[model samples]
Target: MSLSKDKGEQNPLEKALAAYIEALQTKPVLTKAVTSGCISAIGSLVSQLIVPNPANGGKIVWRSVAAYAAFGFVVSGPLIHKFYILLDKMMPPKKEKTALDGIKRVVVDRLVFAPPFLLLFLYVITILEGQGHQAAIARIRESFFPVLKLNLQVWTVFQYVNVNYVPPKYRVLFGNALALIWSVFVASKRRKMALANK
Candidate 1:
């Protein structure tokens, strides 16, 4: 009886996972957008916690969080989803996947996709935060290369695993999972730069 009960019972995590999978199938873009937005907001919140803002007496900046969330939902999620599709289309997977195929995808992702995307992120976030174009350019000048260096170092290994192992449908979700940490770093860096400029 206990064994049967245990088998029938589903934990919240399991139920949520099931729902997410279903949503992905039914509404791929929306699901990814919402998921990415939530993760981005969480990352921003975590950043605020870790590097409390002296400007606001360490209180959580809900506006900043909203900006991050909006960027994820409106930009990152859809763009990433399409980008992965493009990558796969460019280098269609083989019946027998090879190391070379994965390497090519990663190279293109890091070189072609990442740099422009990072610049866009900086620019968009600044705009979303109500900072003007000049601020965006300044932010880019200050952080672009350093952030790109770190991004390549970290995402190269992760992208290899993602492109090689993860299914095309789930690739954006997998990348978003990893992007949680990246988001935190970006949020923190953005905040730090803003403060420094002031």
Candidate 2:
């Protein structure tokens, strides 16, 4: 009876994993987008748990988490998925993924995508946190360059491997996996700043 109960409890999770894999196979783009959202949401939750709000007597900020999840779902997911497609179309990878091709991708991505995307991300998050247009603009001014500099420092090395080694279809998934850690860092910093301002 106990053995049966254990199996029953495990079945749902196993089934869900199987279903997710099937979706990845059948609908790669949508699956990757949804996967990005889910991963970002989880990352947000982890950040919130790690950082407490003294304003609310150390309570978790569900609003920030929800906003992070929504941002992932609405902006990061689909936008990133499409961006990868565009990157491939724009650069047209060589017959064999080579070191030079990887370098070219890294250069283009950092130059073209990173700046605008980072600005958009900061703007959206600022707006989502109920700050107005001016605040959003201000946040961008204050934060964008520093964040972009750090982004280059971290992501350049990773993107070489990501672009060169990972297949096109799987690139977004790989990026989202890596961005999971980045999301945690971003969410925690944003939350702390938000709390401090209050």
> Pick by lDDT: which candidate is best?
1
Clashes of each: 0, 0
Stretches off by above 4 angstroms in model 1 are: 1-9, 183-198
lDDT of 2 by residue, 4-86 (tens): 35445657767676666678778876787777778877887787676665578877777766777778878887887788888
- In Å, residue 148's CA in model 1 sits off its true spot by 0.7
The whole-model C-alpha lDDT of candidate 2 against the native structure comes to 0.79
The true-versus-predicted C-alpha distance at residue 149 of model 2, in Å, is 0.6
lDDT over C-alpha atoms for residue 100 of model 1: 86
Error of 1 at 7 (Å): 11
- lDDT for each candidate structure: 0.86, 0.79
Query: Per-residue error at 68 for model 1, in Å?
Result: 0.5
